[model samples]
Each structure stands twice: as structure tokens, then as C-alpha cells.
Target: MSVKLLVTTVLLLLPYVHTFSVEKRVSKLLSWSKSENEAPTILGWCEERRLQDATELQVTVSCGDSEPLEVSIPIPTDENTLARTLWPSSLAAAILLRLPASEQLVKDRHILELGCGLGLAGIVTSSSAKSCCLTDHDEEIIQLLKNQNIPNIDVSYLEWRDEDRPNDIPPSDLVIGADIAYYFYLLRPLIDTTKAMLRPDNSAFMVVGQANRESQWDLYHNVRDGCYNQLTDEREAPWNGETRMLLYQLQMFKWQVDDDIALENQELDGTIPIAVMIHTSPGLENFAFTTFDHIATKNDKEGIMMSF
Candidate 1:
């Protein structure tokens, strides 16, 4: 088979294959439960233990010659409480503090933090921001943040897959996240949630993490292909021996086109011009070309001009 034909066939079959795989997994779980004659139970339920033994640790953060601010964070002792860790949160906080003061990226802006496990970064930034919202999907984490009673900061539950959560969140001037893109399946929902929570223009999202997984690279490409434009050059810092930390600043893509030219072209050809911009790296030109060609082919009959 030709390469194009094979690619098209796979694309068409992907949805059905994904659905079948999900159904098969569910069936296996049901069969196992029936064989055992009881409901399946997850091991290491640590909610009670975490609440009982959680300790508070003070983290001091300083920005641009400002007096250091100390934040007390609850340390979850349970092995399953990965969300409550402080490594990437510290890294993300450092990056946010390192942002140039001339840009005023966080100062006086409405900042929102996604997956704000221990609320480290948000709490640190709340001092400069007009208001800050710290969000996490875990109920226990939300409760912990609320207990802190930090002024000018709000704590809320936010799961990216939950569409209603975005409606409750106000449009933010800036969105920040740390170590949220560790899983491949989370990229789309996280990006969608960030876009929903941000203003249509002049808003930015900043995310930081250790570049130890492929998902982080996928996140970069996903943002590039989506409605966001990179605001600053990619920033990296040395973390441990071999692992490097990376930060990305992305703003919503805004069109800067001449209305008169667009109108003239539309009047001349009786077709609207649709601009498709692709931001790509050295090795991704073929992917961009394939995307442009697909859109052009799909809209061939429509009264639209596809400009890449």
C-alpha cells in the first residue's frame, strides 16, 4: 500500500481501535471481579494516614531583591501522595521568580495555577499577583490549601476532564502549572483547560518541569500546533546530575493581518481567506506540510482560501 493510503487507513481505524481497547479492559476487570465474587479494591488507601501525619515545611522564596517570603506547605507522608511533592513545585517557583520584572508577568495579574498540589508556586506568586487561584483535582489537596487561609489566594478543585470546572474559573491573565504533563493522555485536556481559563488575548500560560519524559516534548509540540504562540525563548536550568529543568511561556495566538487586504481579496475572489499558521522545528517541516495539505484538500470545494 502507498504510504498516504496506509496513513489514512490507520487514522480512520484509530477511534474504533481505541474504543475496543477500552471495552476490553473494562470486560477484563468485570471478569476478575466476578471470579473473585467481590468488588475490586485499590491497595494502599492513604487518605486517613496522610491527614493524620502530614507535617508542615516552610519554603522561603525571593524575587528580584525583594524580601524573602516564607510559605508553609503540608508534606504528605503517604507513598501514594505524589501530588504533594515539592521538587517541581520548587523548580516552577524559581522560574516564575526569574521572569523579568520589566515584563511584569505576574505582578498585578490574575494568576491561576493548575494541578497546584501543594500550592507552592501559586502561594509564592500570590504576593505579587493581584489575585491567585490554586487548583487541584484531589479533594484532600484542596482542603489542605483551604486550611492555609492565605490572603488574596483561592483554593478550588479543578480536573481538566471536568468541563464544568472551567466555567467556574474566571478568565485569568496568566496560568501556571508544574509537573502536570507527566502523562501522555493528559496533554490535550490540560491544554484545553488552560485555554478555557485564559483570556482570548494578552494572556499567557507558563509551565515548568524536569525534562525526564517524552510527554514534556509532546506538550511543547501540542502547544505549538494549537492556538498558543511561544512568548519567550525556551528556558532551561540544571536540576540534578543528568536531568534538566525546562520552562515554556506561551500566549494565545493573535492575528495581525491587514483588514483592507483581506477584504479586497475576498471581494475579488468571492471567497474568505483562512490563515493556517504552523510553528515547527527543524525536523517537523514534513508534519507541517502534511497538516497544511490535509486542510487544503478537505476545504477544496468550500469557498475558502487556505493560506499557510
Candidate 2:
């Protein structure tokens, strides 16, 4: 009775013992997996806190007559570069908007701001513009702009190298950029993008930059070589008692020649004719003349008017 009863009891209890051992191992495995998953969650929370700390800086910008604008800007670091901080040129651009002349250029107009890092200039301009589009290539910067929820403005992703502009960006009456031309390679693309974004008639491009930078000189030469004509002289805005900011107002050169004039010149000379037009706009007094080969003289002009 003892051996047979002991063997039966051990076999019956063996199955329950194995089941309990298996459950204990499963519980341990589940706990390990939970901890592994939570490690990343904890790390993510720490990264988020770090980001919040990096972006806690806020800037207040005051333009003429308008109320001051408060913007939350990220602290600039080596990693973030120009896309995080509100530069001094952006402040100058905001102040430029206060001028009556600059006001006329933006009032009731569709405006576009390129490379809008902290969106300071765009935010200031939005107060007067009919509508504004703030654009940058960085997704994080775009998210920053969206977080601002500024009125009368839309935020979009715009890369300088993108062949096609975003559909949401309308033909802007005034295109603005602040401290965007820091790189030599990006200058031509910036000019081309500005030209493409601006209206063919009655539109202007306003760019503000630190005047001392070599990139600014590159931008000036590029703009001069391009199809644009400078409308306003180089306006200086002093900053930090050391840096000088320059604001340039540029308009695309538009040529309108009468068919009669061309025909008469061809009939009389039997050769390709040269057209000379005179422009009489404020701050601009130069002649834009095109030879037979469509070569325009370098004489700076505002709006060209020509007749036989």
C-alpha cells in the first residue's frame, strides 16, 4: 500500500508542479518584456523634456505703430544652426515693415516668407498683409510655426531646391527673407525661387541680411546679374552696435514695346533694331536698352517706358 500509493501521488502532483513552474517563467518573461518596452518610453520622455528646454526661449519684436509681437524661438545650437534662433536681420526686416513705403508694398497683399526659421518677420508682416505664408524646409521648424497658430498665416514646407513650389503658396505681391542667404550655393536658388514666387507686375522682393557677410555681397551680385532691378537703395539698420543690417527692395524688370515701333525700326534700318526705354520711378533713374541680340545694358532702371 505504501509504494503504490506514493507512486500515484507523485505522478498526480508532478503535472501541477510543471504547470506552476511554466506560469512562473512566463510571468518573468512578461515582466522583462514590459521593462524593455518602458525603457524606450522613458528615454523618449527625457528627449521630449530636453527639446522643451531647448525651445523655451521667447523673443519680443516691436515694429513701428503696431503692437509688439511675442514669438517662441528655439535656442540656437551647433546642431540647429540658423533654423532655430531669431537673427538680428529678422528684427531689421520687421522694423522695415514699419516704414510707410514698406507698408504700401505689403498692405492688402499676399506675402511669402522664405526660410522662416523662427517666423519673426513673417509674424510681424502678417499683421499688415492680407495673407502670409511662412515656409521652411525643416519639418521641425514647420511644426514650430504651426504651434504658433498665428492668424492670417499658413505654414508650409519649401525647399530651395524643389523644382515645383507648394500649391498652397499663391503668387505673392511681396516676398521676404531674413538672414537666409548665408550659403553661396543657395543664393541662385533663392533668387530663382523669389522670382518664381513674385507677381510678374507690381511685385517686389525684400531681403534683409547682415551687410558685412560675404554671402550678402554674393546675393547683391547675383541679384544684379539676374533679371531683377533694385527699386530702393540699400537701407541700413544698425544692430548690436557692431553689426549693420541691409534691406533691399527689388522689382523684376518688365519690358513692354509697341509693335509699331519695332516694325518701323525694322523697315527703316533693314536690321535688328535697338530699343531704349527710360524709367522714371522714385529712387531709380536709369535706362534699360536692349540691342538686337536682346542684350540689356547694365544701367539700373526702375520701370522702363519706351516709344518711337
- Backbone collisions counted per model: 0, 0
Query: Judged by lDDT against the true structure, how good is candidate 1?
Result: 0.51
User: How does model 2 score by TM-score?
Assistant: 0.54
Every candidate's lDDT: 0.51, 0.52
| Model 1 bad stretches (over 4 Å) | 1-54, 98-103, 227-308
For model 1 the local lDDT of residue 146 reads 88
Off by over 4 Å in 2: 1-56, 63-66, 72-81, 227-308
Prediction 1 TM-score vs. true: 0.54
Candidate 1, residues 6-92, lDDT tens digits: the string is 999999999776543310000000001212355432110000111223366555543335455566777655558766666433333
> In model 1, what are the clashing residue pairs, if there are any?
none
What tens digits encode model 2's per-residue C-alpha lDDT throughout 1-308? 79999999999999776543310000000000112244211000000011223444444444334454555544444455567654555654554554445566678889999998877778767877999999998787787668768789899999978888888789987788877876667766786687678775566566666444556655655454333323334432211111112222211111212323331132221111111111112322221111111222223221223221
Candidate 2 has which clashing residue pairs, if any?
none
